[model samples]
Target: MRLSFTTISIFLSLIRAPGVVSQTGLAPKQFLNLPLGEVKPAGWLHDQLMVQTNGLAGHEHDFYDYVAETDWTGGSSYYSNLEEAGSYWFNGMVPNGVLANDATIQSQTQYFLDYVLDHQDSTGWLGPEVNTTKPRYLWGRYPFFFGAIQMVEANSSLAGRVVPALHTFVKLANTMLHNNGEGLEDWTNTRWEDFVMTLQWCLYDFYPDGNEELLLDTMQLLKSYGDPWEEVFKEEYFPKTAVENLTNPFPFLTWHGVNMAEGLKALPATYRFTHNQSDLDAASLGWDLLFQYHGRPSGIFAADEYLAGLEAARGTELCLVVETMFSGSYLYQVIGDPKFADRVERVAYNALPATLTGDMWSRQYLQQQNQIAAKNMNPDPFPTDGSYSNVFGLEPNYPCCTVNHPQGYPKFISNAFVTSPDKTSLVHVYLGPFSTQTTLADGNQVTVTVDTLYPFSDTLTTTIEAAGAFTYRVRIPSWVANGTISVNGAQAEAVSPSNGLHSVSVAAGTTTIVLNLPAEITLEPRPHGSVAVHRGPLHYAFDIARTQKVLAQNAQEARAVDLEFDATVPWQYALDTSSLRFQYSPPASGVLPSPVYDSGLPPMSISATACQIDWSVAGDTFASPPPTSPECTGPTTNITLWPFGATKLRIGEFPTVNLTA
Candidate 1:
């Protein structure tokens, strides 16, 4: 039996599930994400987002063929015979346009949404799949719904239409799954967590009493039919070595880079339903092992296409970086671990932007920690990538990163803050220049404004305005020691963080709190006896001078071009770890410059003494792994290092040279 729209609304209001806990012992999420548009970017973070809006991301539909003429928007063709490219664009564009409040972007997104919703099939299937006899692929719908739900949440005016449509689709999906799990294959099967996540949202947030059991059963069927990520994460089944070294016919899905990134949260997502202790333990074990062997200093694992090992020169895909950030964000919310949030910041601040051009007009399909050149490689280091894999341009080597990269920072902003399970407090999950307005459980209206250049600047000034008393919590990154928080100019107290978060009992009215997270120069030992420099959330890299060569350009957008870069200055260096010093230069204008990711724009840097070392490039394109031990080959000179995200060409991992020896 189907419930009418009025009955569905009544049920939703009456049984709005507080959290994803059940009598069957499903695990409860520690935190719940604030609805889209509630958290908005501010200060330098907003500037960075504006850069995205002005660059390729904001203009894709106007020029890029895949998005401009894709079937998702009533165009005549599917992108590469699949709905993925357009769906990816929709996923990123929805949040970006909503958060930026850009009229053009909003109009573009609305146009696409209108088309898809207006043309839904009689069988409740979304998009143009109804007209084709080709096998339906469920993978693309995961991203489409992810974006659709956000659009509905941000613009509630669309709710009456969008919500009921989504329910109809879910009912059809249940029927399809029951009929031998049709349409779930390959990518969709491996990434079933994405589908499960959307279902969980529908079940917990908008479930109708009549179809409650159907939704739950569909989730179970999808899990059963999908790739066994939880089982693959087991010690015996997990691949400890690189994919290249694995025996024939190894679990290819687990070794795939993007799959690994998206799969990281599979067990944790599953634990919510099963509540099995093994699922939780396995999730933790898989995370530890994934990073322990294949991880890079940038907080991503090597996977040009598959899992590469811990060499500094190995490439990490752009898709992996953003997916990893999402997984990290999801894990933090589900498991309530501060480390997950920490890792998300690492990838977002360093790896995500590092792959994209400063203006966000172009991007690299793959990025290396020790990258010194951005040209086509003759003998590419990647196991399966092409020669142009590392080139910084539009759709270099592949188009997935092109369409998918836009979601990185915007979603990061969307999840910057979350409400506690009981909704008594608002938790700042990730530190950034953003503000949030959320209503607490007791009907207290709370508005929080954070003003600071975090990751670049360690000081965060938080102003909380509330209608009544409530607890305010902020995450103290795992790297922070000797951090202090002062309330309303009171004497600063040492921040005593429990489980990576510090709580303050704040009374109603306007309260101002200041957080001083002073960071020290820390060195991480790399695989080749080299050290990677870090200060707070930013990873420092030597800013190598480079020359750009434009290979192709779009007539529609002057800034959109396929480009290659070659280092003009020597990049082989061995640092004197003892000589590392952190420096901060506040912007004179009291505001960060637009396009802040450009070289030399960040207000903070590191100075260190280093000398040219005997290092070589692989295939005359990629930087070879740093030497295990290196002796100086040139006179020592002081070098300035900027944030990894700031430079187009850099050496983030440096070998050490002993001058005394």
Candidate 2:
């Protein structure tokens, strides 16, 4: 007899009554995620969406039609390509759908929802029917997990339609666990269980009463099947001393760059249910180990395939950067640590923008800290990724980044605002131009509108609209010292230094707060005696002129363009450490194009004196030049540096010379 979803069927049937499933579950009280559509992107972030609409993410059907026609049936056994397109549409499109007020956006959202609604099997299985031979291919269902979460968070009616399917899918999944776990063995394939655990826990929180036993049973089984994140970190299995680390032939399965990025939050997310201290410790420890040896100034770790060492010339995958950002968002929710927010800001501001064209039309799969060129070569610097990995195009080397990159900015906007457990305070997890509206515990409506060009300018203004008094919490980043907060033009004392939240009581009606976090330039020492320049969260690089080449577009796909960039200007420059100047310009002040990314225009630029220093190139990529004294062979000239995100060929980590030393 075939196994049946007996446990799940009973749980679902019991909860058919209205209001039986409560909107509460095992998520910790301190981490309350606000409903979507409450906070919308404004200013430069909104401009980014306009640019994205012209890119691969907005026209999903144009570039990724495979997903549109797959019909959620496991076509070729890689889970469901439908999930990929669905995930992007749900995350990237919905935000634009609501914000842009475009009909196409709503129709696109409905396109995915309709398939999910129409195709759910009688046994409650979601997505394409599993091909038992390639059963582990179910890893693709993880995208559906994301899509479901976003749907429930954004729309009540849509969520109402989705919860029943989710419950049924959970039951079907639980039934599969009873049969010796056929497809859940491999490390790479098994990673999907982490998503399952997370979705299950989130659903449990929504329906806590009737389905406790079944949810726990499924979760425990997933935990058993997941990669040994706890043990791996405890034993320091990563950053392995010997190249032959894992005895298995496919060691990259465990040490893969993107895998590690997705896995970073796995344990912390599980901690939501387990509440185990060791799980929390594993998340922190694993982060430290990854950063200690492979970290870059952009707040990402180097990984051409695996944990490449801490050299400036090495590249990190674009997918890893976005995944790390997602992980950081979760860690912040779970741990409430400001440091996680710091990571999120660094990647969003620097690494993410650096990899893609300003217009969001094209992107590279791999971005290097000391990249001097981005052309296609047969023998690329990457160990495993192809030569085209650095090309800016649609699906250059991997389609995963193309599909996954859209999640970063939209999710970042979503995470900008959250409330304290007691609902007496609202926290700004990230600083940008956005407004947050949420109700307090005392039944008071509070709305805070944040206006500023942050990371571009230190001056931020917050306007509070509330009739009653409540605490307002502002995050003072750890890097900012002597930070000042002013209310209604009155200067307040510096409250916290270690990335703490500074709270102040407000008098209800239209209170304005101004925050001044002065940016200071600091030189960070890196591997091979190189240096990275940092001012606030943005990293400064020696900007090299780019030679743009438009490789032909796909004949089959509409407007799908391929691009390659070559370094045109001289890249061999060593900075004079003592002479750095800050130049500020408001948006659209320059002759550059409207969208900052589209024109490679930064809202602010830094002027620094530099002299041509001796640097070598190895196989068309920049080599780590040795540190030298303040001797200059060429005349001292001033070079302008925008943020790392605004440049395609940039020497972000440079060899510095100290004249006085």
Candidate 3:
């Protein structure tokens, strides 16, 4: 049922995760995964997104006050309501501009600094321990660690705040490593969330002068305490101890979505920072094992409160997708390969959007494939209370997702544009405007000014400057609008795609790559069971209000119309060159409908009217046979499929319909 793929042959020839190849022995030119940011979209959007989150969230102290005031803890009220409010605010501060002389950032960030300084003990430790002797908040170390690492990435001045916090982390590590008198469990009354968070934060700070002994100690302790990631990849990772942990699935592959994912996402980053090759390699291998057991096409491994089979109605929690993206970013840095970045992009583009509303507000607990509308009970054999896309306000159905989710947007901004070990930098994504500077390889300095209207348009440009000669390799995205290169201003002829990169050689000179994303909105069906509608990197969905098709079907069963919206007559036929579309439509003899997002999945509760997908069906012509019954007909139509994760009601896996007419 799976289309065999070769190892990815694209991206710079960096050390990516091991390859998955096709029967042809060809690897994929690009590994479609998460943390996708082309400098064009990633740079600007990262900056803008940062601005949005921090602006909405307030400084940590302010946000802390707001959430604390609500007195909500570890429940839906906290997860959905308080957590999301926190996320929206945090999103505003992620990218470059958000911190570019922004007064709010300067002030609010300072407040957190003041809080840490005010609390530092004589030993340099920052926060109070979570025990009868000292418990600052109702939670453990995880959230605080995530917040602190994020704050460090936001700005260096904020970094000054980290030292004191490290002290506190070291003390906590001391307890866990030593197993001092219920010391570790005392943090959250034995809850592992705090312990895991504490461990991850320590990992982030692994460097010279770091608590190295403590880190090794905690890693051993974590191994013993059933870190699920450790267990799932035990044989693959700790072949030494596979006999011990892999024998049981308790902590090896538990299906609960949020907790285990959070740990996987963070633990690897820690190992990456310390040059713990064995740990990093083990962690990545474990991720592969996890993917084998529970990966979604969206690039997130499943988290359905437990592992659900691949096509099952229950799968990955929105929270798991976000966490996976965060973790993948670190994998990118550690492995220095664009493959990890590709995975990040896949999840970011597909799964992230599915979790939240179009406007970047609200998210879901679980995201399903046979996602049914919230209004009814199991109408399909596969139906479950779980939904495809859910959007509610603040903390929607669960607060853990809400609280955990907020960290993603801002953190995403930080990793969007990355530098090479040699100081070469790239504008990985397109969203808004921003700037960054890096020390390039060969001891040279370079700064980039990026401009684009990405995910909206494909055309974008990046200008680089350095005093000396250097070769900066820019990425040519697989879904590029259209690619061309210009040295300074002179356009270069297209060269053969080398390792998936179109190398534009510039000898100690400035250059520009004119990127054009396809402006045309196109649709492609899949072999398994869905279709994708695309306009550049931004996948288009259907307008429920005007759409005539709503059933989720395969290429054979479904169809789409080329739509052109008119100011006067909106749903009027826009006409494609071909004379075909889907089978089921306005029953009898009416127009076939388009897939819409109004299924009312409770976890997300997304507003039906906001940001109507730019498309709606205006016609349908069968290219193949229709299903026997309305409920279970498979798609018989033959059509090119848009990428999975781009749109709802599209085929991710497909079947051939081979119709000539």
Clash pairs for candidate 1: none
Candidate 1: global Cα-lDDT? 0.83
Local distance difference test, each candidate: 0.83, 0.70, 0.41
List pairs with backbone clashes in candidate 2: 24-205, 25-205, 72-128, 73-128, 74-128, 358-597, 358-598
Off by over 4 Å in 2: 1-29, 68-92, 99-101, 130-133, 185-197, 240-252, 497-499, 556-559, 587-593, 598-600, 621-631, 659-661
- Per-candidate clashes, comma-separated: 0, 7, 109
Q: What TM-score do all the candidates reach, one by one?
A: 0.94, 0.89, 0.62
Worst 10 residues of 1 by lDDT: 14-23
Q: For candidate 1, write residues 1-661 as lDDT tens digits.
A: 2235575455434432233443452467889898899999999899899999998899888878788844344545556333688788888999999899899998988887777777788998876653456787778878878888898789778878887787788888878877777887778778888888887765445545466666666667677766667656767656666677665232357578998899987888787777777877888788878888888777778888988888877889998998888888888888887878998898889888888888899999999888888888877787788888989888898888888988999999999999889999889988989999989987999999999988778899999999999998999998886999999999999999989889999998999999999888898888768888998888899988999999988877788898888889888889888888889998877788778887898899999888998898777787887887887888989999899998888998888976545
Model 2 lDDT tens row, 434-491? 8878888788798888877787778788999996888788778777866888889886
RMSD in angstroms, all models?
Answer: 7.1, 6.8, 12.9
Scanning candidate 2 in windows of ten residues, the lowest lDDT window is 15-24
Tell how far residue 305 is off in model 1, in angstroms: 0.8
Candidate ranking (TM-score, best to worst): 1, 2, 3
The lDDT leader among the candidates is 1
